[model samples]
Target: MAKAFKYGLKGIRGHLEPAERELLRSLFDDVISMLEPEERANEDPLAALVGLDTDAREPSDRALRRLLPNVMKNDDDASLEFRRYTERSLRENKIGALKAAALSLDREHLVLTPDDARHWATALNDVRLVLAERLDIRDDADADNVHLMQDWAQAEDVESYLALVYNFTTWLQESLVQAMVHSLDARR
Candidate 1:
């Protein structure tokens, strides 16, 4: 039940209830897990469809594919080759962003320096993207339907709660971006 984000002179400022903060921490933890390189090779057939298995290395998960898209979609050989060289570094950058988000959550009040704000924006967008996929949110209309259904959705409905969180994060990201833009404009 903390206020939504707003830009401050120092950085972005906001507040989140302890429970909300914990939820965010959990989300980042899950993302980190998903981004982790699998010990065994990917067994997903969908990877083959995308020609992600062209190389000897394991293909990435669908979520990872969304996060780090192909460098060359038309040429399977080039795309897989590029992925092999860059996927590790991309994963590392995502992990770093998630870690930064967790560090921000450690504070009582949410305060983000410029660097921290960038990390939060990156991490939060990733979380939202994953959640939206899980929720099958195709467009604004689908998202609106989710909100409309909230009136009938029970408090115990996990799906409903997740949708609420997705919506909340979307708003937070939008607000943070707006604040940053305002700050930049002010300096002119």
Candidate 2:
């Protein structure tokens, strides 16, 4: 079991059992792997240094597409053009957040500064997005269906296991958001 994150005198605090920590770290790593852009040979070093990706195209994977959505839904050419310029940086930023969150799991106790909280929140949300795509959770009804799989004992299949994971991440992210809100309110 994990304690819900809370804002207090020191900072945002929470506790996860070792197993929970491992689970979160694995999730973060998986998302980071998915977001890492492929290296292109013969690419201009100057263009790469400035976050330009002339070869970038919309991701074929459903989850990757969700993570790196088009700037304009209805305009394919414009969207692809924009992605060529921005997708690499977006992937790098997401990877950075996921890596930071995964590294934080090495601590026995979770004590988060505002920046850490922001990273955790982003990483968790990305994990949930991937899980949701895997679980085919497209709407409120789909999420409700997945949320019903709360029993670990009943996780007899991969989909059930993913549902349980999704539900757990959703709960964790909600708690984080609540703690973040409390922290904001405390400053006022």
**How accurate locally is residue 157 in candidate 2, as Cα lDDT from 0 to 100?**
95
Residues 56-158, model 2: lDDT tens digits? 9889999999999999979999999999899999999999999999999998789999999999999999999999999998999999999899999999999
**Candidate 2: misplaced stretches above 4 Å?**
none
CA RMSD of all predictions: 5.9, 0.7
Superposed by TM-score, candidate 1 places the C-alpha of residue 107 at a distance from the truth, in angstroms, of: 1.1
State residue 79's C-alpha deviation in candidate 1, in Å.
1.1
Error of 2 at 176 (Å): 0.5
Candidate 1 residue lDDT tens string, 49-69? 453433434345666667878
Please name the candidate that would achieve the greatest TM-score relative to the true structure.
2
Query: How large an RMSD does model 1 have?
Result: 5.9
- Computed on alpha carbons, the lDDT of every model, listed in order, comes to 0.77, 0.93
